[model samples]
Structures are given as C-alpha cells and as structure tokens.
Target: MIEANGFSLIGIYGGTFDPVHYGHLRVAEELVEVLQLDHLRFLPAHHPRLRNAPVVASHHRVAMLRQAIHGNVRFSMDERELKRPGETYSVESLRELRQAYGEHETLALCFILGADAFVKLPDWYCWRELFELCHLVVVNRPGHALLSDPSCLPLALRNICQERWAAHADALKKISSGLVYVAPTTLLNISSTRIRTLMASGKSARYLLPERVLDYINMHNFYAGGK
Candidate 1:
C-alpha cells in the first residue's frame, strides 16, 4: 500500500464503465503510478446524474469491468453505487467512503476524472462538498485538455479550484482532501462509445480493450443492437 506522512492514498475512479475499455484501464494504470496510489477503487455508477442511463445492465457492466482489471493487484471494483437504487450521486459515495475510513485526516481519498467531466463539476449534486470529502485528480481526455488557467474553467468551478490547486501530486499525500491536481496520463484515443459503435456495426474492436472483456461482451451480446 502507498502511504506518505502516515496517510494512505486511495484513488476513487467513478464512471458508467458501460463496458470497460483500454482507454479507461490505461488511465487507471497511469494514475496509479503517477499519483502513487495505494489502492484504486473503480466505482461504477448505477445511473449517472449528469448523463444518460447505461445501455448495458449493471450486472453485465460490472462483469466486464471485473474481467478488464482481473490481474491488477492495486485495482478493485466498488459496487456500492451499482447496488444503490435511483440516480447515483458522487458526493454520497465519497461521504460513505470517508466515514468507512474513519477520518479524512488519516486516509487521503483522491477522486479521479477526465478534464471534460471536471469542467461540468458545478452541475453535480453538492459539488462543493466533494472537495471536503476527497481530492480531485484531473486527467486529460481525448478532446479535452487540462487548462491551468482558471479563466478557462467554468465560473463556479474555476473560482473554487483556484485555492484548491496543488503544485504537485505529493501535495495530495500531505493533505487529506480539498486539493486539485492535474495529473499527466497517457492519452489513448480509445473510448467506450467508439468501441460500442464498432461492436454495434459488427466491426472488430480488438486491441481497443482487453481480450477477456471483449470475450465477455461477445458472449453476452451486450451492445449488439447498437445500444
């Protein structure tokens, strides 16, 4: 486990893994290394508040995610949001995690997301409280690049992030929460949407994701109808 200054750093990567792909896996792997995360939790959402419901069922998505990260020692899936009823709010999950860990002072929870999602933070339910619950690790997505300037960010989010910006990843290990760090991770062009479209069109999505995950998707015929 990765620890610094007597605090264990855990990474919470949440998304509607729809069907976990290499893009997601690569980012997680890189984040683990770059941030020196002790344990990285992949929290799959039941129904994202800011997005549409996943096309595939929760069970299937969870299964695919399991296969995708099968042998990764530091990676684990957290199914709490999947089991919860109704829309999934990140704040609630972080709150529960903070309580489970006993105190934010002892354990550092770093919530991971892409730059595209970070800009939309203000729209999230109780978004500001998230800073109090965990640090934010922002990575660049395919089209969205990380913007250092606060002016480039959404007004509300930009204002809050100004004081929360961390000079280095190590800063996360020093403080338990309320910091924003822009981490540099491998920029893979692969995306779940592209994979699904390829599968739906009866095209090959090989190498874009793990073979085990692909096999599982084929076995269940999960996105066969362009879902």
Candidate 2:
C-alpha cells in the first residue's frame, strides 16, 4: 500500500519458512536497500508444489515470521498464499495482487529467491506470465556454484540464459515486459535447513537467527525432533 517516486516496490519473499531465520532477514534487508523497495512482504506458501519434504504447519510458520520482523516498519506479513486452499503458484498470486492494487497504480512487484531456485525457473507453473506481473530477483547462495555447463539446460532455458548474461540490467528493466531477470548479490551460507539440523542435534543456532525468533522456536518446541 506504500508508494515511492510514483512507483511502489513490493518485494515478496515467499517460502515454507518452517522457521524464519537470519538468512531470510538479511536478503530482505539487502533487496529493500539495493533495489529501493518501498515495502516487503514475507509470504509463506500454503502448499508448495515442488517440495517433497513435509512442511511445518502454516500457522506456526506465519507466527514465526511475524515475530522475526516485528520491529521493522518496512516489513509486513501476507497470509494470502498460505490461506489459499490448493497448490501455490506465483502467477496466480501476482494476478490477485494486481487486481487488488489496480494495474495503473505505478507499482512494481518483485519476488526474492535464491540462486538455487533460479535454475529451476522453467519448471514453475506459468513462469513466463509471472514476469509480466512482477520481477524475479535471484540472490546467490554462498558456496552454491553456478552450472558451468549450459549444454545440460533445456533448449528454451539455455536461450533464456544467453539473454540473461548478455544484458542483465536491460533484462531487469524488461521484467514487466515479460522477460525474467537474474539479480546477483553477496551469498550467505545460512539456511533454515542447517539451522534445524543444529537444533535437532542439541547444538546452539545462536547467531544464525534473530534472538527473539530463536526464543519463539524454543518455546514452541519446533525443529527439536519431537523433543
């Protein structure tokens, strides 16, 4: 609902968020600062189609996110995706948001994702149409190497890769014109997966997440392997 320079930059950070952690907060902060975003929303997917592992309950995830970003004025939580009944798709969410905000509102929406998700963009539902509604900002993950061999990519994806590497800035500008973009940033090695692993092993996940978030997780007995 906020606007800046006749344009509102709404950054969507969507994930299972089994538990919100420092890596998630760091990326959101970086995107807001670097991209000049007006506001950022932490969206927790209700049913992520691609995830094979069982996710924690949606309500718990949402609560954790709310706690993590409590004092940040620019950050807010949107449970729309988590409330949806079926499979969650970016295109569908974009359409709904556009309707709510109106098309001519001078708003620019961007979805923040890790580099690991970037390579699998082709497999997403209606991914091409998604770009028309919002920009995809792909942040690099620490220690995760990019594919050196482009030959292994699907022909369509390989072509897209060429376009991306050719003119990244131009591609980003063309995001609203139905072209995908890759945004590169400093990668942090922290991840919820690693954090959870540490907690289950009776180790401290101290600096890996916000102190309040860690307290909340401990209180709720989350990721403690049923302890």
Candidate 3:
C-alpha cells in the first residue's frame, strides 16, 4: 500500500506520463501550494481511454514518474490503474480512491485536468459521476482555453460548474461532494511528444525531464535510436 504520509487532502493527476517532464511537474507544484494540498498524487494510466495507448509501457511510465517526484515528499505516484486490466477510465480510478479514503469529511481528493481535457470531459466514461467522487481542478496550458462561458461547456457539465464553482481555495476543503476550481497556474510549454521526438532523433531531452528519468530512457533505449 502506498502511504499517504499523513496527507488528508490529495489531488489525483492521471495521464499517460510516457515520459514525465518539467511541464507536468511545474504546474503540480503551483497547484499544491495554491490549493493547500497535502499531497498531489501522480497517477499514470495503464490504458488510456481518450487517446491511443501510450507508446511506452505502463511499468516504464511508473518508473519515470517515481524518479521524477523522488525528492518531493508531498508528491507521490500510485499504481492502482497500472495493476488493473482493460481500459483505464478516470471515473474508475476516482472510485477506487473514494473507496480507499472512505467517508472522511476532512479528506479532500481533487482530480487534476488540463483545460483541454476539461473541455472534453463529456467524452469520458461515466463523466458525470466524477463530480460526485471528488473535486475537479482544471488548469490551463498551451493550445487549451479554460472555459469561462457556461454555454461553452457540455450541456450536462454546465449546470454543475455553474452551481459548484468555488470562489476560494478553502471552499474546496469544506465539502467533498462537488467543487469545480480553475487554477491560475504557471503553465509550462513543454510536451511529452516533443521530448520523444527529440530523443528519437538522437537529440537530448535532458532538461525537459528529470535527470534520472532521462538516464533511464537512455539506458532502456526508450524513444532512442531514431525510432
């Protein structure tokens, strides 16, 4: 079992993490501070639903994430989705967390998503059930716009966002049922795709990702040898 390390409030950030980069970590740091989270959980999906299966294996993704967050006591990685078979869905992972954490009023779990991903929320499996499971922390990054107009949201999500948009960070700590927070973060312009491309062409993606992670990629020949 992964220890929460005395963290009552946690954020779940799930993604392919093919090779975790600084872009992913930078935003996480800001969110942890802004939301006052005890921990920001990095969850690497075993089988992604919205996009193609990650080119890198799930085990590799997990290792890279572990290396990326090694020193940060408040940041940890979970392997629940990696252990499960079939396609991984955001809602299913959230359900597992809700079950694990139980009904503690003091415990808060926030699901982190980029603005691009949030705008496409309706496409997720059991998307509507997400709000019932945990708070939604949406952040803006390149090529994605944070939704401001309620009309732009999916019909099903509009009402919930309208009703539950928290005006302050403490508002999220008050209740566990439903909360929508759009964080103004220090969004980095890095992308895993670009990193992979550089590595494939024999160029270094050194500073983009953690040093150990890059070493692991080099040792394993991941996205190397002009693939």
Q: Give lDDT per model, in order.
A: 0.89, 0.73, 0.84
Candidate 3: regions farther than 4 A off: 1-8
- As a whole number from 0 to 100, the lDDT of residue 152 in candidate 1 is 85
* Candidate 2 lDDT score relative to the true structure: 0.73
lDDT tens digits, residue span 73-99, model 2: 999998898777888887788788777
Poorest 10 consecutive residues by lDDT, candidate 1: 1-10
Per-model TM-score versus the true fold: 0.95, 0.85, 0.92
lDDT digits (tens) for residues 104-214 of candidate 3: 656879999988888888898988899899989988878776766768787877866778998777777777758898888887788999998988888878788888888
- Model 3: per-residue Cα lDDT at residue 119: 81
Candidate 1 off by > 4 Å: 1-6, 225-227
Candidate 2: where are CA atoms >4 Å away?
1-7, 146-153, 161-179, 225-227
Task: Tell me, by TM-score, which candidate is best.
Answer: 1
Model 2 TM: 0.85
Better model by TM-score, 1 or 3? 1
